[model samples]
Target chain A: MNKNSLKILEKNRDPFRSVKLTVGITISIIFIFPIIWMMFVSVKPDGFMTTNPVEWFTPPYTFSNYVDLIMNSLILRWLWNSLIVAVITTILTLVITSLAAFAISQMKFRFKNTIFIFFLLGLMIPGEATIIPLYEIVKSLNMIDSYAGLILPMIASPLGVIILKSFFDGVPREVIESAIMDGCSYLKLFYKIVLPLAKPAMAAIGIFTFIGSWNNFLWPYLSILSETLYTLPVGLPVFNSTYSQAYVQPMTANAIASIPVIVAFLIFEKQIVKGISFTGIKG
Target chain B: MNSKKKAWMQDLRALPFLLPFFIAYLIFTIFPIFKGLEMSLYEWNLVRKLEFVGLENYTEMFQDEFFWDSLWNTTLFVILTTPTMVALALVLALLANLNTKLQTFFRGSFFLPSILSVAVISFLAIFMLQPYNGLVNTVLQLVGINAEPFWMADKTLAWVTIVVVTLWWTVGFNMVLFLAGLQDIPESLYEASEIDGATRWEQFRYITLPQLIPIGRVILLLQILASYKVFAQILLITGGGPGGATRPLIQYIYEVGFTKNNLGYAATMSYALFFILLVLSIIQLRSQRSEGK
Candidate 1:
């Protein structure tokens, strides 16, 4: 309350405020630089991309790269493949994970703990570690070069089931009990009570699953040898290799591939953040 | 009697929900893992007759120089990248949490790269790290730091460069997670610390750090496990290197399986990687749980 006290308070605050600002600016620049640079390069004339001294802001911006990518590359097909696979995978993951979570959390069952542990073992096994063996399995099934091959293996993600189960466990047990007591079938109880209460967690799981399936590259690359079945991530490299001289084409393809994810993040930023936080907590 | 029958019926009803995952896991995960273990015992080409060689592949892996080199490279990568990436993510999260102008801009920019598929980021990284006309080298020249090291050319530096690129690509996702964790910590704790004449450092040490420990441990574990399995960037950027310098275990397995047509040896190596990850994750989980207690 005294003048000297107030002055000291302001002085102490000054260092904290300045430090926060400096740190904030420094991190922001580091985070933003690559993305900004990529955008600049995508628009730059082909020859200017590797120019020394890096004239990042100059004009002579060209749409030729975009035009060339659209006209020649299988970029659209790859995008389609990515979209179909991601969407189907997301849907399948949600249904199976939610149902399994429901059974584990609410339904009375013997060996429930044992089954949960079985799924938990999935948490330890990295997908890459299983890739070689899975490749053999896929080949044996003759599912190579198919969307089913990509989507089927991904749907059994143990992480999804675990997250959903944890979420459903936190739901008030009385609600499900009452629903059952009211002569509601188990299916109806799940449809009405559990699904609605589980929305936030479901949204969290959905966004995580969508982003993961979209970004998946290794399995798709190994399994799908046909160019027609290539996803965006896989197809972009092949496009780059074939058109090695045309930097613009691949750059444009990269930019296009980024659009859907960017749009999804912008729309559901909060849910995505929450989902990531959940993983950090449960991880 | 009726109650028992109903319970049985309930269990039966649950079967459909569990069936798909079980079937898929059996076909894709459980069965293949066993099959992989079986294959590791024999030497079989894709089209040729199989030869049972017992633990010969495992023994060969121990003596094989490339196998050891890849394992070492992967371990080094996991060690170098995990801590830096996790620490950088925590710092970025703290920075993003501050009530500053451009908060959204900063968050979005950091996350932008993570959203982009790995192919795009790897391609750009390769282009940027090129020695002669690359953006990084060009900037280094301006700063008067001559003698630019070829990132993917030299053996030692190639692995280091790949690790750096991996950190850049992934740090944002971890940062986003950390930011969410920061948000969950009560603002009143910081206020109470301030009232008690706590400096920012003390506040961070006592209040913030304790709250973040659980999240930090999880992130660290995930990063360690995931980084050990790093393959795509290695494949795309260095193609397992300018002499196997950057080949991680996963890429090694890939080569053994696809290139050499030696599924058995590949399976054995993959199992080795899995065992390492399992032990590491268990250690992390135990330490964190004990710390909590």
Candidate 2:
């Protein structure tokens, strides 16, 4: 490397580094603005959010919105409903999917490939296409306005089984074979060996299920008619409309509703990223 | 007989774990899909008797202007948003992958919006796009671009607002996927490119893009399909209003089915959307496979 060449390299690298830094910082701010704004509005006093030439961050920040939301709104009810539905759905989905994936991946059951293909075909059918019929079924079952209606339908996720099945297939066959040679039953093998080995993939699937169930709008919106039974996403809109006069309070309600999923993501960021990446890879 | 009994018992043991999903699918998914097909052929309100009016609903759907408009709007949205969101996600992922001090913070910040429900985001968007007192208009005025148009009022601007909001909410997830893809790409490739005196652009074009293609295709397909089914944001933000400017097929279907009690017609419209998505996904998958080959 000559002196002139080194100088040119340094110049090029400096500009490249600076451009990268600028772009990175700009994008970070753009992405973070909405959530930060939501939090800001939540703490701001009523009528302050809508002021002309809007104050980005006004003084005399009030925790009254949060206090008001807690005392007045059906937030706790909605959060409890969301939690029950989300948690049950996640656990049920993991169990069913892991078993189905194991069967499809390891067991040579009759029509195994055919059943697997059937599930894959299910992936192509948009939920909107079947929603009307689902409504009818829910009505017929007299399950409307119940958590059973909300959670039961979502328990069967084709994407979950497909992703987990692929992950399970990557588990070395020798481990299974050795377990079988020791007179281990299929159930015992799955519980003792497969479940533990597939923990990362299971965590990924669980996170996906939880986030999806938490954010689900259309299903709960259509099914749950009772205000008392509404989940956060469904309930927040109705709450906002009902309390339209109090702008900051609903904003506070909205912030409170989003906290669980946001906190969940922050804690299990790795699992969330892994789950999203898995979806991208398999799709 | 003992061996056969043992085999049957093992199958029974596996049954408990698999039962929930199968039962859920059979009742909620498979049965409803078939019922939806059946419902499309009938003329009945929730309380009224079903009359066999085969194909009438489908015929009526073709002449429906709202259906056509919604379809067009949805198609336009899918076309506009999918590529831009995927590209932006890829760029963000690349930037995040670079060795820097604020990598984790930047990644976390970008992902923050995705955790909120669409309803909350749309409400905030309504505030931000307020014509007089909104932050966006204020920013535009500061930049000397006075006479900033109302984003959610005009038809075209409404569509643009929906797309931008959707992108902001979704790009983080796709970016995380791309980041994972980038991490999977061996560090030795970049080192080798540097050794060969390859410029960053050349290295990205050759190594990064090629490695990211499979992940890219997945993101593209998911975005296309998901965007086609957008309803919540549209409902919350536009309500398919300002003269139905932002109405998508799903929202239209919801209105027809629940609001108007036109289940038969809504079924027909949903079927049409189903067919369009089916065709597009097949084409996308075929093209992707051929490209890989």
Interface RMSD of each: 2.3, 2.5
lDDT of 2 by residue, A212-242 (tens): 8888999999899998999988988887777
Worst 10 residues of 2 chain B by lDDT: B284-293
Please identify model 1 stretches exceeding 4 Å from their true place: A1-14, A46-50, A54-56, A281-283, B1-4, B285-293
Fnat, model by model in order, equals 0.59, 0.58
DockQ, all models: 0.56, 0.53
Q: How well is each residue in A102-172 modelled by candidate 1, as lDDT tens digits?
A: 78878877678999899877766667777777887888888988999999888887777877787888878
List candidate 2 segments past 4 Å from native. A1-14, A49-54, A243-246, A281-283, B2-14, B142-145, B283-293
The all-Cα superposition gives candidate 1 an RMSD in Å to the true structure of 3.2
